[model samples]
Target: MLQAHEADIFRPDVTVLAPQEAVPARRERFATRLSPQDLERRAWKRRVNTIHVNTDVVVKAVARFDQMLADLADDVEGQCLVVPAPSGAGKSHLLARLQMRPSLVPFRDEVGPVRPLVFIKAPSPCTLKTLGLALYVALTDLELSATLKEHDIWRRVRHQMHAQLVSVVMVDEFHHALRGRTGDERRALVETLKNLVIPDPNDPLRPPGAEMRPISLVLSGMPWLRRVLKEDFQLLRRCIFMPIRPLGHSAACVKKATKFLELIEPRLGFPAPSGLSEHDMVQRMLKASAGYTGRMMHLVKKAAFRAIRSGAPSISQLDHLAFVFDEIFELGPHRNPFRVPDISTCPKLKEIEFDKLTRLMGTAQADIDPDDA
Candidate 1:
């Protein structure tokens, strides 16, 4: 080999190497604190990172609902989709996920961004005026200073929706319209919604060169929403009901739980002292969650935080999760599924029935109302 030049050998721009490699950035974990606000924010943010266990039922339901939405986009006469479920059954989560689909992507023209899907929550004690105001704020991102008449608000709502080319309007907690309202009021509310979907013959909102297509409605609420819809046959006829049931103790449920545990284990930032995928463990988890996916996530998050705070390198089923149920959720000793020996035969598991209506209405309808409101 030729001898290197003196200038090159003694170059001042030589890069120095360290003996140890640089550490990679780690995912931010929840701070070990008791602040309610911090915990709530962390919990909400963690929702995005949590594993979404899609059982067959969820897949089929999503496919069917998506197909309906696609059909509505191309049709002149818009239809309605009613998603009814119990509390903590992941209805909001499902709708949120659905809103992210490419189908809901905003359309752009020479003017600016035109959002196709308008998602709004029905205000508490929802009336036609409140509902219209909610939609107005969601569409225009502005509040009304002057109190406008219900008719004026609705007219503006329709015009804005048409101008913006909104294809679907998903209203969450739609059952609020029925809550603490008279029968006539409920009927009037339903009529207002109907009018929005299909404008009156002499509607003033049909401006020159305005798109005449109807805007589809996607309403999600508790099971009582079905009962509310039953009051108006016309409204019920326009809707396609899609029921979201809670996860029960079945082979499919077990499989989903196992898959979820497997996916989440790595992301938990700590190892599990025992296998979380075992049959008994899965059953116990189901019981603890009361067969609800949202509750299951809540339990898991609480347990994970407990493990992190205790300076544990791994989560222990006996030490961490058992204590979490007993302390955090305040389950009685006899009713604590995690602490119990036989989860399959646990009395609390038996109490976790699919019929949430029983709690709401006191008795199950022998024949569910045909209107299914």
Candidate 2:
């Protein structure tokens, strides 16, 4: 179900190593045993990669995606499931989990190859031609010419999708389709997308009056994807919008936040576990992370590493988080959410230079702040 794109794409099939002790070999017959701190440095790297805390929102998203695919199987009346969320809401991670489901894996039965689902990340500077090519490559092993016309490319893409028995086509980072475009361009893109969900009998792409097989679409991206649907009345009518809500300062949200903290605490290498699930720590974490799940996990990962580097027994205090926040986010103590006396007065991350933050973190800006202008 998961397809790899050339740029700004996360492969679902990538491996995550398990945590283990490290022993370096010295001279012959001599093996240097690593200290706990030395081993933990390497162990935490592997442990963090293995972490995936599935909260209720993630569960519901996956359930909705599954139901969409199921409905496609029965009726083939292509439906659109629009997942609109911020960059760090774990939209890509949701697609990664869906692709891992065994039932959806491409297989062959009495018929030819059956690809239940196909996933592709929408290309940067997206165009009808590039989108068609991306989908074409995922559905078949055949190569496409770089100079191919858009109509020819989509003709092949449609053929391949139908031939492969594709029930659902998931496009992550769907917001890219509308970025930095004119009114005419945006309308053109939206019209092309509408045909994917509900083909027009009169459309020249298909033979005249020919019946077309319907394939459900799963489009996940920033909140702007809703704008694409709004471009057409019919497209909006067929879409099921699912927005990922940020953590709020409510009792129920605090409980969910506590569960997430407890889930991750064990994986962070420390002499003893921190009381990350405590009400006070949970409140601070909510403020520090700006209520985004990905940001919360990233903050904790760096805080744990900071504790390790400083020889702290555990990241058990707000000071560690406060320092980590200032260091990584390039914020002073006043602007650092963890350090601010009044959480309400904490500076929003939007006010900061997102590109510089991504540079400081040594991560791709697209991976962390895809929605940022």
Candidate 3:
């Protein structure tokens, strides 16, 4: 289970509106409109809410979806697919983007049925039962009952699903069930995947004469998932592994860094933004992030209040690096003598001025060339 502290601690969920023409008024009820701040203090929520800012990652996410379609197009026999990346790699962000994006086409037009995208996170306190519950919930309002015949439940859901074309069921954090959990939990999880991504759904449970819906279960998690799967009996063989490893950020991401900075401003209770240049913002961010998602998120967050307070239209490269260094998650635990319980509220030394970072940091100009000090 996710601790309360972990919930919305890193990011907030955001809603982006597509062009009005693209959305129908009634269907638009599902729309989430994000304010500027959602990307600031609650950027982690954005992990489940925001659009993918980084294009390369977006393409990869889409590509992964396409791969899922292709694999299941012929045979929906594969075990869940895994998208694994390192801690700072932004796996959740990518997953969230995919979750929020609307269908490229409608669920149906004049056609008989179309596939709908069904995305879900595996319940942390998840089990085979919980997995069934998730699938059940996604399909309809049915109560979770072990006694409910699997095929019977599917028959009902399958009928519902026929109204839509492909239902891509995305399960994030597959590794949680795979590693370090109890054996029963693992087995339960495996069974859940089997029942969910069953090869065919028409004739009932998997045997020679059975038919199944070609549901795609994309499971994502930390990089260790690949290794974790190796130890499992049938899982490693059935699933195709998609490494969610971080690609070095592109010049394009840094090119207009101001967009990200402004995107993060509202999260920190910042006022509306004014004039800002993209070049400087991107440059500063690139330096601070050194190209890691977790750190990048932090950098965006830390700069919010500062950028707002200064009335600067854009966060300067200097400011970006300073915040990134100060707030972003380091590759490992951070250690610095200047660090305090809360840098914002740390008591000023007797000789130092609050506004003068130099005296606050107890360093001379030569010793601290950076603006962060």
RMSD per prediction, one decimal? 15.4, 9.8, 14.3
lDDT of 3 by residue, 1-373 (tens): 6688877564457455477854785567876776675444355433323323554555776776666666665775644667775444456566666665555233556865454666666664555555556666765656656677545555555455545554566766655554346766676556545555665344453343334655556677655556445645555666766664332336665443555554544443334442233454344344433344444554454454456445555544445434444443332212211233233333222211111322122212111113322
Candidate 3 global CA lDDT score: 0.50
For candidate 3, the per-residue lDDT at 188 reads 51
TM-score of model number 1 = 0.74
Question: Which residue pairs come into collision in candidate 1?
Answer: 226-372, 226-373, 227-373, 230-373
Tens digit of lDDT per residue, candidate 2, span 1-373? Answer: 4554643366457654344322222243475678887896767667765678887777887788778776765663578888887655567777787677776888887878889889988887667777888888888866699699988888787777767777778898887777666667767777777776787777667643446767778888777678767887777788998787788888988888988999998877677778888877788778766576766777787777777767778884665788777777666878777777776777666613444543444423333334444
Backbone clash numbers for all candidates listed: 4, 0, 25
Give lDDT tens digits, candidate 1, residues 1-373.
4368877787779864453432221212433545886665466446524656675556766787688677765765667888887655666667776787797888789986688899987887778778889999999999864489877887788778777888789998787777677888788778767655665566565655675677778898767787677777876888888777666777887788787777666667664444666778878888776676656665676677776666566767767788876775455767778877777666653322333422232322222233442
| Worst ten in a row by lDDT for model 2 | 19-28
lDDT of candidates 1 onward, in order: 0.70, 0.73, 0.50
Best candidate, lDDT-wise?
2
- Model 2 off-target regions past 4 Å? 1-44, 108-113, 141-143, 207-211, 267-269, 305-313, 316-324, 340-345, 351-373
Total colliding residue pairs, candidate 3:
25
